[model samples]
Target chain A: MTGIRRDFQKILLALLLGALLPASAWSKTVIGVMMPGNSAYFQEIHQAFLTTLTAKSSAGTTFEIIVQKPFPDPVALSNAARKLLAADPDLLVTYGTSATLAVLHEKSHAPVIYGGVYDQFTAQLAGPRATGCGFKIPLTSLLRHLRELKKVETLNVLYCSLEEDSVRQLNELSELAKEQQLTLNRINLKNREDLKKAPLAKGDAIFLTGSSVVAAMLDEILALAKNHQQPSVGIFPDRDEAGITIALYHDPLAQGRKIAEIAAQVLSGRAPGDIKPEALRNTELMFNLKEAKNIGVKIPFQLVAEASKVIK
Target chain B: MTTTPIANSRIICRVIVLLLLLLAVPPLAFAQTRELVIGIEPEHNIFTQMEEYGQLVKYITEKSGIPIRLTIMSRYGEVLQRFKAMHLDGAFLNSYTATLAIDELGMAPIASPVSLAGESVTRGIIFTRRDSNIRRIAEMRGKSIAFVDPATTEGYLFPLALLKKNGITDIKTFFSHHFFTGSHASAISAVLDGRADLGVAKELVYQRQVAKDPSIAAELVILEESPPTPETTLCLKQDLPADLKRKLIDIMLEMDQSREGMAVLKTLGLRGFTRADKADFNIVRQMAKEAGLPGRTSKRQ
Candidate 1:
C-alpha cells in the first residue's frame, strides 16, 4: 500500500511540473503581422487588432505585434521572421500570402493564423496551426450588380503581376466567369507606369481587386476606366475614395476583430485546426451612381435599396 | 527660327489635325458599357430564346444602355449553385428559386413577369378526379397526393402553402402516400394515369388543358387554388455591383414600348417587366417560411 501511494505522488508531481514549466517559460512573445507599408489602412487594421487583443487579455499579459512591411521581399522578410522566432511568439498571424510564405519557411513551434488572405486552398496558406478568415470579397454581389445593370456578359480586369492579391482574385474570378459562361480578359500591369498605358477594351467593364499597386495607381485606373466609357469596381472600400465606380468590399476593421477573437482562442489552448477558419465578419456591396452615370450606366432603384452605401 | 505658314494653309492644316484627333479617339469612348452575366434555366430555352421572344438582348441594351447577355443553365439547381459560386450576375428565376436566392444566395427580385391580363401573380391549384369524392384539401387526407419536385415553385411550393392555410400539415397524417413527379408535366401525367388521387399544378396549366381537352378539365376539379403569387422575375446575384444592377432593373421595367422588345415579351407571356420591391414577394416568402419550408433546404423546392 505504501509503494502504491509513493508511485501516485511521483506521477502527480511529474504532471504538475509538465504543465507549470511550459507556462512559466512563455514570456516576451512576439506576434508577427505581415502587411503593406504603403497603406495607412493596413496600419489601422493592425492597430485595431492589437487594441482588441490588449483589451481582452488579462492585465500584465505582455505581447508585441511586429509588422513586416511591403510583402514579397523574401530575404528581408526571412530575416525579420528569424528575429521574431528568436523572440518566440506564442503564435503568428500572417497578413497575406507573401507574409505567410516568409513565416512558413522559418522553423517555429508557434501556431500560425493567416489574416486578410484569399483562395485558402490555392495559396496553401492554411498552414499547420493555421486558422483565420479567408477574407473572400463578395463576387456574387458584383455579378448581381452587373446583371441588374443589363450588362451581363464579359468583363475586363487589370492585375499587377507582382501583386499576389491581384493574381489570387483574378484566378477566383476567372473560375467564376467560366462557370457563368462569361469571358474574363486579363490585362496585366507590370508597374504603375505600365498601368497608365494599359489599353481598355471596347465593350468591357473594368474589375480590379485589392493590391497596393492597384491602389496607388487608382487615379490612372479611374482615368482609364472613364476613358474607355466603362464602369469599374474595386474589392476594397478605400478604393472608392480613389475613384473606382464602387467597391465590393470586405471590412478590414471587422476582419481585425475576427482575428483577435481567433487569436484568443489559440491563446486559450484551442487547437488551431479545431478552430475552423471563419469567413469575414461582414461584407458590403457599394456603388457609385455618380460614377455609373458618368460612364453612361443607369442605376437601378431596387439595387440601391439593398446597398450598404451608394455614392450618387 | 520657324517661318509662319500662310494663314489659309495653316488653318487647313489645323483643321486636318483636329479631324485626326477626332478620328483617333473613337466615339465609343463616350458610351459607358457596364457588363454583367445573367444565368437562366433552360426551361423553354428562355436565355437563348431571348433573341426570338423579345430581342431581350437588344431591348435590354437599348433600355439600360448596357449590353446584356444570357447564359442558359441546364437546371434550376445549376442556377443556385452558380449563384453560390458567384458565377452569375443576375437570373430570370421563379418564385421558389427566388426564395432560396433571397435566403441563401443574397439575391432579391427587381422585376417579375406580368400576365397578358397585367396580373403579376400566379397560383397553385390542387386538383382531384372530378368524379372522385375528394372535394376539398382536407379530403386529400388519407389519399395519395402527387407533388412536383420538392423545389418547384408551383407544384410543390404553392400546394404546400394551400395545405398549411387549411391547417392540414403532418403530410403523413393528411396523405397515406406522397411522391414527387419532378415537374408540372410529370405531375399532370401522374394525375391522368390514376397513379395518385390528387396533384398540384399552376392555375394557368388547368386553363391550357381545357383548350386541348375539355373533358380533361371535367375529369379533375380544383381541390384548392393557392393565393396569387408573383410570377418568375429577374434576380440579381447577391454580390453584383449595385449601380450596374440598378441599370439592369431599369432596363427590364422599361422594356414594354420597344418594338423589338415587345416580341420577346409576347413569347414569355407578358407585356413587359414591372418594378418590384422586396415587399412584393413577402407573401410567398412568408408562406414558405410558415410551412416550415424556409430557405434552401431538402424539403423546399
Candidate 2:
C-alpha cells in the first residue's frame, strides 16, 4: 500500500513540474543581417545596426543580431541564412538582393526585415515575410542630372555580365528607362582592354556601376570619358575619388541601422509582414566638380544644392 | 432566484459584447492615422540640397513617426503637376518653381539655398559655341540658342529675362532656333554638340563641365551672365504638422555636430543648415512680385 502511495506522489510531482513551466518560454529574438564580405560601407552599416539594437533592448527580452559575410557565391549567402535559421531566430535582417534572396530561400517562419534593396517591386524582392527599407538611390535623378550636364542620347554602362549584383542593377535601370522613354546603351566589356576599345559614338555617356572589374580600369575609363568628351557617372560612393562625375549612393552603415530598427520592431512582437519594407530614408548624391569640368558639362545650381558632397 | 438568474445572464451578455467592442475599436482608431508623404527631387550636384532633405526627413519622422516617401520627378513640370494634383506633402523647390509653387500652387517657402558667402543666391549664364561669331547678347539675335528647363533660374528664368531686358524680346526672332534642353548641363552640351549656336546654363555647372571635358570646354564661351536669384528651398504643404515642423527645424539646426547625423547631411551637399523663417524669403517674394509674377504661377515654356 505504501509503495503505491509513493508512486502516486511521484506522478503528482511530475505533473506539477510540467504545469509550472511557462506557457511558452519567452524567445531570444535572433536577427541575421547578411552583407558583402569586402566593403567598409557594409561593415559600418552592420555595426551601426548592432549598436542601435544594443542601445534599444531592455532587460528580460534579449535579442541577437548575426552579421554574416556572404562571399564567393550567392549560394554561400543561402547556406549562411539556413545556418542562422537553425538557431530559430525570432526575426531576420538582410541587405541588398544577394543576401535578401539567400534568406528568402530558407522561407523563414520568423519575420524578415530587408534593407539596402533598390526598388522592391521592380526587383521582385517584396517577399511574404520580407519588409524593411528599400534603397532609394535616385535613378531618375541621376539620369536627369546627366541630361542637364549634357545631352548625351546614348548612355553606355560598363557592366560585368557574370556579377548578379551588376546584372540586377543593369536590369533595374533598363526597366526604369522604359518608364521614362529612355534608353541605356550597354557595352559588356570582359576585360580592361576591351572596355577601352568599346565603340564610342556621338551622343554617348559612359556610366560605370561599382564593379571591381570596372574599378580596375578606373583611370582608363576616366581617360576614355575625357577623350570622348563623354561624362562618366558611377554608383559607388568611394569611386567619386576615381573621377566619376557623380555618384548617387548611400551609406551602408545607415542602411544597416535602418534594417535593425525594423528587426527590433519584429522582435518587440510587431508582425514583420505588417511592418512595411522601408526605402533608404537617407541618401547622399556626390559629385566630383573637377570631374564635371573635365567632362565639359556645366552643373545647375538646383543640382549643386541637392548634392550631398561636391569634391573639387 | 428566477430574477437573479435572468439578471446574471443579461450581465454576462453585456460583458461579452463589451469585450468584442473593445477589441474592435482600439485597432480601428490606430488605423485611422494616415501617413504623410513628402516628395523630394534629388538634385545630386549640390550636397546642401541633399543634406537638407536628410535632416528634414529625420527630424520629421522622429517627431511624428510619419514615413516620408520621396517621389523623384524628372522635370520641373512634373513637380508642378503633382503639386497641382495636391499629391505632395512638401517639396524642396528652386526659386523659379518656388515662385510658381507659391503663387500658383499655394506652396509656402520655408527655406532657401545658400553658398559659402552666406548669400542665398546663384545665376545663369549664356554660353556660345566658341566657333560661333555671336559674342555678345546683341549678337545672339538670329543664332540658335538652347535653354534648360523653363522653371530653371539659370537655365531658363534669369537667362530669358536677360534677353528680354536687353531689348531682345523674341528668342525665336533673335535666335534662328530656340530649344528647351531641360537642364543646365544639357544646355551647355547642345552648344558642345554643335546642335545649338548658344546655350544658357548655371556658371558652376559650366565650370564643372570644363573641368570634366576640357575639349568641350574649349568649344564654349560665356556670352552673358544673369543677376543672382534666391537659393531653392523647403516649401511645406498647406497643413504640415506643427510638431513635425519644429522637429525638422531643430534637426537642421543641430545636424552639423551630430556624428551619425552629419554623414547623412554630408551626402546631401550643405555646409550646415541654419534656421530660416517666413520673412527670410521676403527678397524672393518681393522679386517675384516686382517681376509681375503671381506668387506661384509659372511662365509657360
lDDT of each: 0.68, 0.65
Which portions of model 1 miss their true places by more than 4 Å?
A1-28, A37-41, A73-80, A138-140, A147-154, A179-183, A201-203, B1-301
Off by over 4 Å in 2: A1-29, A59-65, A86-88, A160-168, A175-183, A187-203, A210-230, A250-254, A281-283, A293-302, B1-301
Give lDDT tens digits, candidate 1, residues B59-163.
Answer: 677666766677776555567788767557777776777767766666767888777888888888788766456786666777877786566567777777667
Give the alpha carbon lDDT tens digit for every residue of B1-301 in model 2. 2578889999999999999987676422332254555565533333443455656576546644656655555776567788768567677766666666665666566665444455566667888756456787778666677787767666766665566667765666777777776666656655654446677887766765676655455556787776666666777764555555665556656766777556655554455566544455445444444444444433321
State the lDDT of candidate 2 residue by residue for A5-43, as single tens digits.
999999999889978865334556666667644444555
Q: In model 1, what is the error at residue A90, expressed in angstroms?
A: 2.8
Candidate 2 has a TM-score of: 0.44
CA shift of A269, model 2, Å: 2.3
DockQ of 1: 0.02
